[model samples]
Target chain A: MKSIRGLLFTALLTGLIAAVALTGMSVYLRVLHELDVVFDYQLKEVAYAATMAHPDQLLLPLPSDSASYEREARLAVQIWKGDQLVYASNPKRPIPKQRQGLTTLYLDDRQPVMGWRVYTLYSKDKMIQVSQPLEARREVGIGMAWRSVRPLIVAAGFLVVLVLVSVSYGLRGLKRVASDISSRSATSLDPIEEAGLPREVVPLVHRINDLLNHLGHAFDAQHRFIADAAHELRTPLAVIQLQAQFLERNTDEKERAEAHRQLKGGVRRASHMVGQLLALARLEPEMGGSADEHLSLDDEAGEVVFDLKPLAEANGVNLALDTDTAWMIGDPEALRALIYNLVDNAIRYTPAGGTVAVTVRPSGVNALLQVTDTGPGIPPAERERVFERFYRLPGTSAGGSGLGLAIVKSALDKLNGTIALSAGEHGNGLKVTVSLPRAGEEPTEAPESG
Target chain B: MRLLLVEDDRMFGEALQQNLRLDGFTVDWVQTAEDAEVALSTAEYAVMLLDLGLPAKSGFDLLSEIRAQNNPQPIIVITARDARRDRIRGLDYGADDYQVKPFDSDELAARIRAVARRSVGRFSSLLAHGPVTMRHDTHEVTCHGKPVTLTAKEFAILAALMEKPGAILSQASLEDRLYGWGDEVASNAVEVHIHNLRKKLGKEFIRTVRGIGYKIGDNL
Candidate 1:
């Protein structure tokens, strides 16, 4: 490609140079033609004076005066009248047969010869013929042509340099884009928001941004699925551990009973985790084609489970729900997972006798689902990482596999919901607020919901 | 109380049955959802301890079928999965309560009795803890059978404390009970409720476990 561009540029430059040279040369040739006529006329004048000076001097080429005159004038003078042999300088020179007004003639050596311009002077009973060789005038005309073309040659050279410099500079944007895209890490799908220098590059930038958005979402889903799976596997192991412990120290029925109880709790934990994991995996957006995969997550808000207030009360945490019955379009199971996670996380972290209030409200077009807890609030810097899979708060002794918020975030993404973490009422605890699309939208109706 | 236990693990199920019998409850053990269904069809159980991971039919499916037949019997789901979603799911599908695996047998028994008693609509009497007794129906309190004068807020505080014998009740929880949703609660509302409850019920009834929450115990 580079060679092709270079060749094209060279061809254009050569053509332009040739055009200017040809134009200047033609004009110089025309001026030389006019000058040749004037030179021939002077020779005729000389011839006329000689013929008048002596009537019997017809065939008079051996004269030293005429020869010296011709040499001094830089013209080979010849005189021929009425088709007779003419007086010519250095008699070896041939004269034209068709004697008339000035015209070009060719010599035996192929040099151009100028035809004589005659003054017949019939009243004086004599004729005058004058001629000059065209070599000297031809040399001067060729010199003028070269002189006219020198500037054009230089200008064409400068133009080629300018074209090279500007074209390479203009192409730098493409090179920058290539480097930016190639150097990116496999998982970094963040879009490039900076505008390119040229308008022509905008389309490419937009396309890359779109691809990055899709890739980021895909990675998020994958991460959530893995975390959910790990959480699901933990419960059964906990159950096995409890049962083993019970068997190891079975001195009394009370101890065995306690082990059995612990085993049951572990099994429940494992099963619940597995169920949530499966749902999360299934709900993850498929690779590519995400734009059309509109998930109806808003309608699921009405599918409330057993009221959580009793559980909160039993745990000595306050549960206050402020929203009316609202619908969200998303997987009902996933929504339940998100809500349970938020509530569970609140209950676990809140000091006993501390309040955990859950409120669902209408925020603009979307539903605002918030869970506020009177626990120690997450720091601003760490708030973003709390959504990552298996990320638990730093100092809480709460017993959890750490998939709660991860599942919530995964589900929220499917619903195109937004979540924000901020300080709670007293600015002493964490408040997680989420916004989900309103129910009954066409995107929320999943084909498999039935 | 007679309890029916549906579990797939034979050893664990048998052990649980034996232990529950010793804990003053007549226990019936089954290994599959099908057997549990048949037994439940004919027997009367005060509470059903259902394991969700049963063979042949999942415990959830059995519970759904049972609920479809208009059975409102208290069912507590027992599973090894500790995910909050699963517990809510089980409850959403009509299970009464959920308990994770590796739990204490005493705690399980306590939950069952509490659920079973509530299911049987036995909320007319007072719940007595040490010298403090709070009548559920009338929302009245008595100490050593002596009439105890308490405000509505103080009564709620003491009721929350008495409900969970050894468990801690966070100050936030007490305040939530006192105020409804959207009702602005002062920051020190729970402290005030605790102070009022102490003045009426004696200071030792509610123990302040600093940095955690408040707890009530029989020793207090």
Candidate 2:
């Protein structure tokens, strides 16, 4: 992984160096061109100066002294009369004259001098020319250009350092967020602190905090659920233990038989509790995902009633279903569990010769499912509390883990439905009414299939 | 021993009652704290097995009531609430011993006997008089270093007499200890058991009181 500082520094430095180099090149070429123009003007002036001098003086051969040698190395002066060379600044090199204003000619006759820029002026019976080596002109132009561009190279280096430091400073908040998350305990779901966060990273922090909030709630719910399950399992286990003790110590055959029967009953109750707990866990709202299958609530309820008929018969309770074809979009398994819990609860609570009736029918744009039982109903004040997990009403004789209504409520919530418990027919028992939107209606929320 | 059991869970309470009966205890089981309070006020119990989650009033409230009334019936709390704080609270509320649910019924019986013995200013389950030693756990009696096998009724009668040495116990009280509700007893059942016990052990073991019932001689 590339460090943000390194990446930013590299990119900015590359751009700065490219810009400096291009600007330097353009400045050097422009200065060189200007120097050429000035040199040509100076050449014309020197040729004019030579023309103004006496023709005899221009023709005199200059001696090769140190000062004169330096002057001749840079500048070459020549006089031509009638296309014949009368005089030259370097006697070993004869100048070749160009047509007029500015020309370049290689003075290679000396085998060492490379090139020259020459200018000529014409007067009556006198033609004077002045030239300078091209190497000398370039040396002056580039020397001055270097003086102008040296600061830009230095500034580019400084800019790279500044960008690196600033980029690292800007990215410190991201590193802090990473370390904060990494150092946290696995069980800790607390939100990350957002104070003093960079503007670019605040949205990320907010999203992470939101996820932590949800996770914390989910963990808390799981913990509470496990605690409640353990507490609910204790009583039945205690009953089984005591029954086994009774069976072990009793010598009377009748008492032993009774103990054996109670032991079996205790095992059955414990098994039922475990099954209900698993059903409740499976019907959790978060477990549902994209339930798009269309199922009939009437058919689902009929199946649940058929399955629970034996239980109702064993308890001597009359179980009946009066339902029509009512279609709704939901998970078949969850819907079945919902109906089973309600009917099973009703049958378990109702006395012998009592009745438990289930009905499902379409009402307008909604499907209504109801279970009415002739059992001792929950009081109006305690009806809502009964839906809480593992909460059994005091003094009730029905053997239950108290997760039946809770499971029903959770399933209904997942299906985007509503439930209400009120007095049964004739106002003597419990009637649970559930309403769900019919298929093809605008759903409150799409149900997720398990 | 007579014990009062206060528990709301019907199956658990009934099963625990049956086990305690088999352990040679006359258990009066009540389903609510209110009924427990009433029973405690009316009867004498050797110890009480109290469950915390009750219908009307909780066992905690009943424990406070019992302690406030100076009732020292050696209450042993048997509850499903096994949190450390709950156990501390139960003990603080004057419970003599605490047992959590799903506990071994034999262990509970042993603890009951231990607490019952402590209430009577004894520290051991073994009742020794002269050469006779009765082990409560195994219900085995030894006389002169020889094991003596006794019927359950005979053991119950001997245990009742050994509970308070030299204290006169009425025939009705002995009958109460020997039988629970619905157990058919002949009118001379205590006499028949006493006769058999005398024949098996020795005539000098149990002494008959003239107007009272019977007593074990303190003299070895």
Candidate 3:
């Protein structure tokens, strides 16, 4: 929930304040130094002026009127020749000096403690000294420092205001984009308008638009599939309804029986189509499955063959299976369905007396599965179309849902398998070959065989 | 009356053909648009019941091709394409009517009869010429206000002739209307059906021109 404008405003304002503070501090320090320079110069001027007159005139009362005022502002002038004090501006606080240059006196020869900026000079056997109290320079420096730092403080305040206003102004485009996205409906996958957007944010918006385009395409494809599935279901349902109506209205017993038979067949076809459609819907999304179960391809294929043996026998078709140790990790249901559909389609399409053979072989890297049937094979031109959902070969009499191969394809995709179709046995039947990547870690020996 | 059904799905076409037959219309079925074109060129179907999703040369192509040749047979498109735009395109391609799939068989039969009737400048399913009155929907006929039983072929023949009274249909055209392909047409099947129709509707109801055809006359 952190706002970019707020953060920028805070950082910039803090930086400006720090810079203004440093500038103000340096300005105040420089003013104090300059004030000390002026005070030191004045002290020397007074000491030299006393020497300008003759040594005898140094005893006359120098114009150090600062002593007439408060004690804090007083400038005391001292003249002495070899310890015989000649003159003193303030007799109560007489300045003492040992050096001929400037110095401060905390305790003069007999006076109490008081600090001073002292200037002492010896001219013609007479020492001239000028001392100013430290308090005087401090008051002047304070007055000058205020004048120097006030504008900087005002500018810092103005800079803070400027940063806040500009930060908010610069972020208005982002705010507008957020509101635009929030106000849209879930189904509105239209691309966001990039006009007038800031440069740094353009890449992010472009990526979002790309994602939206993909989502829109996915939604469209899903919708089209559903519509096609529903449409395909309608014809079967219509047949069932019409047959039921005919069965009800029929008066002749023979016709009634025929209608009843058709009704049953229609219901069976409709139910079979529904089951296949459900299998496809369930398998399409979780491709390869989120949770894969380690299972043997041979075992699943054997299970499928075992289940379909009765159907094969009834149709007078011989069904057989041979397998080797082939292991894979995938959704067991998808695998089972895949094997079941391929075999079931072969059995249904093959005429009576035809045979279907399923073989599984593991070649270390890929698990190979082959299903060959003595059925009327697909023409080379139509081999690719058999995998499309609801596409049926012309004049195909088998009562298939038309989704069997489509389901098989989806299941194969889940297992990361490839399927190839070609003529089987003297070019008279269909052979579907599937190869799935084998799983790792082989057991010491093959456990079961059937 | 006879119809040509252009549907690819065998079971659907078979069931629909049977349903239409029970409704007293002879229906000839073809699985592809090419076959439909062959059938259309050879026979004179009263109306065309077309399915759009054929194996090749879709019904839309057949429809436009036939209409482009100025063939005026009424066509009713029965299809799974229920979109509004599809319907508009179908009608724009010169189809007389459009019927969506999974439709009631009875409604489809009625629509077929209605379209066929409109094509012949008739507005009702019942045809009245002289003493015979035939109801297309009920497959019932009455002569001089008395109910008379007629076979499906008999009803089809009388309806065909009664479409435009006094309009002569040649013997070959009469046979075409009376039977679909694969129907065992007796050597004199149309003659037999016409004789039966005449017996049921009175002797003078249908007239035979010497070298031409048969027609129902307004002057009974």
Candidate 4:
């Protein structure tokens, strides 16, 4: 969109350039016109004076004597009364033709006698013709015209520069809008600010902001649906869990044992699904339920340890961690989920004797958490898709809700961070790295935690 | 020993109550946070098996209320919400332990007993299997009442093994419980502990299944 300053600048420049061209042409024509009258009158006067002097030659050039030059200045012309052309004391170049009124003719091979006005005076014996070149006349006219055109040119240049400066300032609003939008995660659909827009541009900004608001609302509704569904589903699952515990209380030996197993399986499945559902719901940015999650990954990592290594060992996989002190801004629960999911995924997919290693380091302005697993590596085509919701790679026996990586992606995105999946060390398995910015940076890195 | 089972689901609650009674826990069962509140208000329970998802109020809320009232009941929060937050939240709200759902009935009973014993200030109870016996409180071993001497590490290893006779315990778990989290576990730490244990207690007393974890002698 062209700004108002740009439009006005273009209009002014075009008008000024055209005005200059027109004024120059008109003044040049006017100069020729005025020169025609003045030179013709002088020619006639000079011819009459020379004729009155009764020159013997019919076509004589102006005399070069000092007295004649003085008389020529008084007459305001050059007198050509001799038959052969002669040099003039005035040293002004002569015209070639004896034509009446304004006429252009070649005086020399290179120069043309333009706008030369002519007249003739005839006596009984001799005819005299007087003429002057038009070059001198037009120079004065052009000089006068330039004085009028200079201000327009200066004004036009200034207008253009002012427009450029103002236009660039106006364009910064759009750039700010772009930065604001891009800084948000995939699920963040907040409206761009409409304040500080140009009067004319405000409508467009309003429309865009309105569209963002609608999108945000839609995302909110979707997330609310999931959250409500998960909440409602918990009651029945809890009922069944309690009922299972109740059944084990009443049944006899063999029946009681079988019931206990069935009950346990049901409760475990329900609990697993509930955990997955919560993680998935939290992944959506519009819900914004995780906004209050302000815990340092560095401090949390140092203090919190759940003894789940037994699960890995029981599954015939080796679990190890490379610890480092690196602080980051994130939800502590989300960080735990990220680590747990990676480690759990590794243990699930890895064959017996395989090793999984987790490393934490401080990335530039953020903390870097990496999990490397010696399992069947994810195919290149499926690597990016793995972070998507409910996207499970084909041909794996691992039973999971497929929300693990999705949650990690969402959490990292919220922290204004990034995650990358790559080939593990030595090209043997999968390595996933997540980087989250530190807290208390610019603009309060975390969402408002209330 | 008496066990108090607090659950909201009618069927599961009744079944668990019956099973605990049969397993010799003079069991008292209640449904809903209110009923559990009333039961705790009236009667003394040895150990409270609390389910987190209750009808009137949540198990976490009840646990907090119990703590707020200064009622020092040893609570084991059993719930279907196995998320890390739920476990941590329950612990923060004054639960002694957090167990995820679909747990083995026998394991639950064992945990209940262990927690009950811990509440009364006993570290471990004497475990007996046929003719073999290990005393955790006294740190001694006996075969048919004849005392057997074992090294410190060997005794520690035997105590862990005898504590859970049938269940297989992984090397990492054993190491974590024996030594703290920051302790460096040697490559042959478990092997050394097991070898020393076998020298004093008969080698057949502890069984090592190939490619899996270890279990105490089942046929002792």
Alpha-carbon lDDT, every model: 0.68, 0.85, 0.83, 0.67
State the lDDT at B54 in candidate 4: 68
**Candidate 1: regions farther than 4 A off:** A2-12, A15-23, A26-123, A131-298, A304-340, A343-363, A370-398, A406-433, A437-450, B1-220
**Candidate 3 deviant stretches above 4 angstroms:** A27-38, A51-100, A105-115, A121-129, A133-166, A286-289, A394-399, A441-450
What TM-score goes with each of the models? 0.40, 0.82, 0.88, 0.47
Tell me how many clashing residue pairs each candidate has: 45, 5, 0, 21
Q: Chain A TM-score of model 3 versus the true structure?
A: 0.83
Q: What is the descending lDDT order?
A: 2, 3, 1, 4
Model 2 clash pairs are A288-A448, A289-A448, A289-A449, A290-A448, A291-A449
lDDT of 1 by residue, A1-450 (tens): 356358758887878777887867796788688866666667666666666665455445435545644454454445455556545654655554443455556545453254333322222433444555566566566667778877887887788878877767766777787787789887778777556556777787888789889878868867756645654464455455546555554668776777767667666655665665565565565622223332333323323313566666778887665655455545555567777778777877887799887777766678788878898989998888888765555544243555677778877776678899999996888899888776543434556855
Please, what are the lDDT tens digits per residue for candidate 4 over residues B115-165? 877886667577777667876444568866788886645665665666567
**Interface RMSD of structure candidate 4 (Å):** 11.9
Q: Is candidate 3 or candidate 4 better by TM-score?
A: 3
Measured by TM-score, how close is model 3 to the native structure?
Answer: 0.88
Q: Per model, how much of the real contact set is kept?
A: 0.12, 0.78, 0.27, 0.14
lDDT by residue (tens digit), candidate 4, A1-450: 866666877786787788778877786777658755665566566667775653344235445324742243332233443455432323454544353443444456555544444454444544455554455556555765777677867877887788778778877887787788789888876677878866766788788888888988887778765654554355446546545655646556777676767576556655765787787566667667565455666555433224558777888888877777676655566677666676677777878899887777876677877778899989888888888665566544243555667777766666677788888989889888877775542245577779
TM-score for the first chain of model 2? 0.85
Interface RMSD of every predicted model, in angstroms: 11.5, 1.3, 1.8, 11.9
Q: Which candidate, 2 or 3, has the higher lDDT?
A: 2
